[model samples]
Structure formats: structure tokens, C-alpha cells
Target: MVSIDEVARAAGVSTATVSRALSGRGQVSAGTRSRVLDTAAALGYVVSAPASSLASGRARNIGVLLPVVDRWYFSTVLAGIASGLQSAGYDITLYALTEDPTERAVVFETFLRRRRVDGVIAIAMSLDTAEADRLAALGMPVVALGAEHRQLPSLAVDDIAVAKLATAHLTDLGHRELAHIGILHDVDDGTEREHIPSLRRRGFEQALDAAGIPRTSARHEHGDFTIEGGHAAAMRLLTGDAPPTAIFAASDEMAFGALIAARDLGLSVPGELSVVGVDGHELSGFFGLTTVDQFPHDQGLRAAREVLAALDEPAPPTTPETGPAGLDPLPFDLVVRTSTRPPRRES
Candidate 1:
């Protein structure tokens, strides 16, 4: 019912000053900004996004790309990004890159190229060299989350190191016969084992080697990064002739599955089989699961910060932090709980 002009008239400020104050963009004195805001609030006046875009040459919207929106990691990161962007007065446009290659192609070739957003933040999607070039060609700042891109600003944890730490925790607890539940694309879930999962597998193997434990093929199972997948994998391993004393799941979801499977098999946790996982999943505490806490939400916040900084600067954005062994790997911690302990002595 009201407009910017009415608010500007009430506040005794120019329309441009009202715009600057409302958008928090250009120079406006504190007193003027306060008055303008009060007037706009009193008058129920709202700034038009289209008009603002036309005037500032910015959409004030950031595009976010994710492989799947249903997963815990993806959803949690999105929540963080949403809160951070809202506080900074920016909007978000989400693009869910489906499993189909054609669908993903459409997102990059069409959706992202529409010139509607000022920046992009992609989460753990396997963007190849060509895809990365296409994103860069958009001429907008792009930041990658949970994966490293040499050309884009990124935030990622050292998956290999985190995995090794999880495995080492089990080994230090006298888990000589240990197994790992990891992601494998050949499975029904069609999970990808390119970046984080693959790196974690390598770390698991390295830890086993360092502990002088044999890295047997029998000790590995592809869980597809899901609780159900981990349950199935644990079912098979636990029923085997020589079951492992402990299991290291690449993700907390899988570890939760392993815990369930152990319980189903009448095996006592930490007493019969120790389990450990990565990701500080919300349910981890309730489950009393020992885990490596990779703060996905924080990664989202950092990625948003990087995008905002790039958008504010006149120059090109700074190079992103790479991972697996970055100069500064994203923060992570090993949380010990009831799920893991030194393997029970063989009577």
C-alpha cells in the first residue's frame, strides 16, 4: 500500500538515500539510515528487488548448487548458508543437480548462465575441468564447499587425515582386526567415490598399514554413504568367518547403521565390536557414537563469507583453500563416546 517515495518524503531524505539506507549498500549517515528505516517500517514500504537490481547491477542473490538436497550434510550446510545470507541481506537461488548427467548439464549450461545471480557456491559436486571452466566462464565469483577446486574458492576438510584419525583411534584401542565401510558407486545407491569418500578410503588403508595390520579385501565393504547401506555391509562382514573386531564408517550415518547391525546381531557395542565414523551428525550425540566431527554447517558459513567478500570487492576473488592437506584444513575433531573402546580381550 505504501512506496519508497512516501517513506523518503516522511524521512526528509532523497529517494537515493532511502535506497542506499534500505539496501545497506552505498554511503548513508547513521542518523539518516535510522530515520529512513523507521519511516519505511512505519509506512510498510518494501524495496523492489527488480528495481534494485537495475540500479545496482547486482541481483543481490547467490546461486547454490548441490547434488542432492535430501542428505543430512547437504541440508545442514544449506541451513547455515540460509541463515548467514539472510543476516547479510542477500537472497539465495538453489539448483539441485540431479544424478542424471543431462540434468546436471542443464544446470550449468542454462540455469547458471541466466545471469540472475551474482555468485555461486557448489557443494561437493564432482565438477570436472570442463564444468569448472563453464562455471568460471559465468564471470561470477564461485566457491566450492567440501571439495577443492584449483580455480575456485573452496572450503574442504582433509578427508584422508580425518579418516586416518578415525582408523587410528580404533587401532590405538587394540583393534587389530578392523574393517571399513565406504562409498562405492557400483552399489544400488549409485554413490560417487571420487572425492571425499575415496580419500577417506585411502586414509583408512594407510592407517591400517601404519598399524602393521593386513589390509584385506575381505575387510572392506561399500556402504554407499547411507545408514541402510552400512547396515547391509555390516551384516555381511559380521556374519563372515573371521569378523573384524571393529569397523570404521566413512560417515556417521553409516556408523549409525553399523551400530544398529551390531545390535541386531546380539553383539554388544565396545564389548564385541567397536565402531567409529566421521561427520558431527546431529544424531551422533544421541547415538553415543564416537566420530570425527567435520563441521559441515561451518563450511557453509565460510563458503558464504567467501562469496560475500568476492562480491563486495572490485577485483577478482582470491584463490580458494584446497584440501585433503590444505595449508589450513577446515576444523575437525575426534569425539570419543560409548561406541568405541579398546577391543575386548580374547579370553
Candidate 2:
């Protein structure tokens, strides 16, 4: 690797000048900075991360916290984040957290304190008062995605409204007997309020109530936001007595499963049962499923931009609502497709 000393000599400037020009930290004449940059590029003199950190007191790294890595939504968001952060010349340290209390304690109290990261981006994780306190104590910019957090700035969709829009679509299509997959029963994913399924369930129930359909009358089955889970849950719903005319699944994956179950039971989609789901999964169009498109990749990009702005980095600035107490509502839309239509009139 070429050293900074060689580049400084070639550029006819001091190493301090080269450092300032590359780091963008101190004042240097434009002509000198340009020359130093050209020379550094020519010599392939990349600054050492440790040396730069020691000098600037910055890690130039962001830590990402995730609950599950195997899921489609989480993976897509992570891809967007990685692209944005890497483009900004920053490295990322991924932190995979589990449900174990001891492990979480170590992360917030011990691992984070090691100063390995300059800031944190938490994706869809519920934080208790204690966890929130520990994060605040870190004195680093923290941004969360797909969550409603009081202590941290978040980029989240109004899930309740999103669900209402989806449910209303079915009701407007003249479907009354509707089944909801992915909500209803008591589930413990740390905090129900912060959990996506619980919030969506609230919206689903609210929409049913507004349609003059008693929440009690509506059919429901629980799916764990996976295709397999959706398949099993949907199979049960379809096999039961007086099966619903339409089903509103909380996720596109579940909706896919519902479609499969409908096929297995020899039911024609839209002719007998229509289905709708959440998340603008890539496979949604292929499956011809009407869904609410939440744009998970865009969410990730916005999240990374928010974190960079918080760190006062030279990234594209977001709106004023990115303050510590702000809750920036992300965008979502309902996409109509072949899987959803008015139920056929009963003969």
C-alpha cells in the first residue's frame, strides 16, 4: 500500500495538508487540496481507518441492529442501508440480536460501550425504557426504521392507516365475510404496540367496525409473517365451516399462502375468494395479489440518510422532522391486482 508521505511529497504539500484535504476536517487552500487529492488518487493512498479515527476521534462506522436477518423485508432494508452508507464512505458493523435477555443486556450495556461505532441504526426492534436509556447514554445519533419510538427519531409508515386502506378496499368491493391472517390472538414479540402484527390488527379491527361488521364476527387466523406460517393458517381458514369470501392478510407472504390454499381447495381466485396483503413484496406482481406497497427498500435508504444527517455528515439532508423527538411518517400505497375483485353474487 502506498503511504501518505509519498503522496504528500508528490503533491508538494505537508502530510497535514494531505490529511485535511482527504478527511475534509480542516482548512486547506482549494488548489493545495485538489493537488493532494489528485496525488493521493494517483498513488492509491487510502487512509488507514484506525489512524484516521485516532486523529479525528470518529469511528466513521455505523452499527446496525437487527432482530432477524433471514427475512425478506429485513434483508431488503439492509441492502438499501448498506448501499447508502457505503456510498458515503462509511463502513457498517452489523449486530444481530436475539430474544435472550442476557444477550441484549450485553449489547446495550457492554458491546456498544466498546466504542466500535459512532452511531446506531435500529431496524424494527422494540426498546424498553432501560434499553432506550442505555442508547441515549451512548451520546450517539440513533435512527430506527419500521418502529414508533419516543426516544429516537424513526421513519415509519402509519400502519393503522395502511391497514385501514387495505381493509376498506375489500369492504368497498362488496365483500363482507372477511378473514384476517397474522393477527387477533395474544402474541408476545416483546412489546405489542411496537410489533407490526399488533398494530395492523388494530387497523383491521377498526376497519371492520367502521364497515358495520362486528369484530367478533370477522374470521381470523394467526400467521408468523412467513410463507409456511401463512400457508398453514390459510389452510385452516379455508377448511373451516362457512369459509370467508375474502381474506386480508397482514403480509404479502401470507397472502401468497392464502392463494395457494385457495388453489389446493379447488377454489377460483376472485370467483370465490379475493385476497389482499401488506408489503410490496417483489413476488406480489407475479402472484397477482393486491397489496399495500410499503417500499421497504426506500425505507432503508431514508433511514440511512437520517442517521447520516444526525451525525452531521455530508449526506443528503432530510426534512426538519428528523429531530430527536420527531416521528417521520413514511409513505405507502394500496396496489390493486388480479387477486382482489368483487365477490361473485351468491347463486
Candidate 3:
């Protein structure tokens, strides 16, 4: 098999020059770098991660923690992080914290403490005070994805503003009766699922108030962030005595369920009821659902970059700060589609 030494010999360069050129680090003449790369590619030479890590005294790996891997949003973010890290010559180790609290404890108490990774990126999993402290005490750089930590850096979207924009979109379309389907978790989704709901719910109510529409308890229902849950919730809401003219699902998956529910009830989309959702899910375009695009993949990429920066510095916190810690709120865009339109008047 071809090796770095062979590539260096063939390229007529020293081993140090070959290393610098192949790794794209240090200074090397452009001509020499090109020759080394051509020689290595022709010989099918591959760089050894272990050797590189050993030489640099760094693992060259980043640890990513996610509550669940099957979820679309989290998995999309993970993919973005993986792609970004891979492009930057870093490897990823994923730690899935299922519903087991003990496993989560082990991750915080032991796995992260082992110093096996240069940095840690957490996705949507809110670390408790103790867990945050324990990880912080490790002194490794930490970046939170989609959730904010006071001590760590994070990337996410403004949930309240997203809700307001979605609600306002429906209100502007002449829909006075509207409903919101949001996640209700027994445990928080780690990003103020507990607090964000209240804020977004308030935003929804505020939009209604501004439009001179009365806020009613009947207009609110909580889903489990799943299509089936959304279908069930929307089924109940739509079948009620006074059905809403439009529905704003907190996520595209739920909005998809609502779409299905609308179909099952013999209702015509936009003609009978309008639907909107957040989280620019890939399928949203296919489903023709109007939505607020939160760009979760970009959030993950930004969070990974932040983690890399923190790992490069590893600074200590000195002062108490106000507001959400580690929170880098990403932007959102309202994407209109065929799913939403003016409320229909009785023919």
C-alpha cells in the first residue's frame, strides 16, 4: 500500500513538507503542495486519524449528544454537524440518551469527563444545573444546539417570534378563528419547551387580541411532536362544535397530521380550512404546507463551529450574565404555500 513516505519520495519533498501539504496546515509553497497532493492521490494514500491525533495531542473528534436519533429535526441537525465537522477534518461520536436517566447521568458524569473528545455538542437536550456544572467542570468546550445554556454557547431559533409570525400570517389572511398545536412533554425538550410554549401561546393570543378575536381555551391543544399525536389532536379540534378556520402547528410533522385530519373529515384544504406549521421540514414543500423555516441544519452547523471555537480557547466564565446563556438565536423566514389562504365564507 502507498504511504506518506512513498508519496514524499515520489513528490521529491521531505516528509515534513508532505505532512504540511496534505494536512493543509503550516506554510508550504503552492507548487510543492500541489505536487504532494497529486502524488498522494495517484498513490491512493490515506491519512491516518490516529497518527494525526497522536502527533497533535488532540483527539480530532467531537462528541454529539442527542435525546433521540429517530426524530427528523434532531437527525437533520446531526447530519449538518457531521458534515461540517467532517469537512473540517474532525470526526463525530454520537451519544444517544434514550429515556434512561441513568444513561444520561453516565454520559454527564463519566463519558464526558474522560477527555476523549476535544469538544461536546448537545442537541435539544437541556442539561440540568448539576449536569451543566459537571460538564462545565470538565473544562472542555461545550456548545448547545437548539437549546441555550448560560455557561455554554448555543444555536437556535426564536420560538416565540416564530409562533407570532405564523399566527400573524393566518390572522392576516382573514382567519379569525385559529388554533395552535404544540408539544406537551412530560419532560422538557431541553429548550424551554416548558417556557417557550407559554411565550408562543402568549404570542398567539396577542395576535388574536390585536385582530379583535377572542382567545379561547378551546383553540389550544398539545401534541407529542409526532404525526399520530397531531392527527389525533387535530381530529378532536376539527370535529368540535365550533371548528377553527385555520390551524398553526408548532412543527411541520404535526401540520402534516393536521392535513391528514382535514382530508379525513372531507374538508378541502384552503377552501375549507387553512394550515400552517413551523420547522421547514423537507417534506413541507411536497405537502404544500405553509411554514416558518427555522433552518435547523444551519443551526447545527453554526453550533458546531461555535464548539470548535470554544475548544480552541477553553476560557473560564468570570461574571454572571443576564438572559439565556449560550443562546445564539438563528433567524426564521415565513414560507407561504398553497395550504394557507383566506378563510372561506359560507356559500
TM-scores for every candidate against the unseen true structure: 0.92, 0.93, 0.90
lDDT, candidate 3, 1-347, per-residue tens: 77789999999999999988977778999999999989999999988878777766678899998888998999899888987898887889889977677988888888877777889888876677666666666667777777666656667677778888999999999998888888543455443334545556666777788778888632888877789988998999999878998998878898999999999999999899899988899999999999999898988888778877776666556333442245546999999999999998886
Q: Rank the candidates by lDDT, best first.
A: 2, 1, 3
**Index of the highest-lDDT prediction:** 2
**Cα lDDT of all candidates, in order?**
0.86, 0.86, 0.82
- The weakest ten consecutive residues by lDDT in model 3 span 318-327
Candidate 1, superposed: residue stretches over 4 Å from native: 184-194, 314-328
All-Cα superposition RMSD per candidate: 3.4, 3.5, 2.6
Cα lDDT over the full model 3: 0.82
lDDT of 3 at 237: 93
Error of 1 at 278 (Å): 0.8
lDDT of 2 by residue, 1-347 (tens): 89988998999988898899999889998988889988888888898999999998888899999999999999999998988898887899988889899999999988889998988999998777567657766878888789866666677999999899999999999989998998567555445255778788889889998999888888889898988888898899889988999999999998999999999999999889999999999999999999999999988888888888878853333332442666569999999999989989967
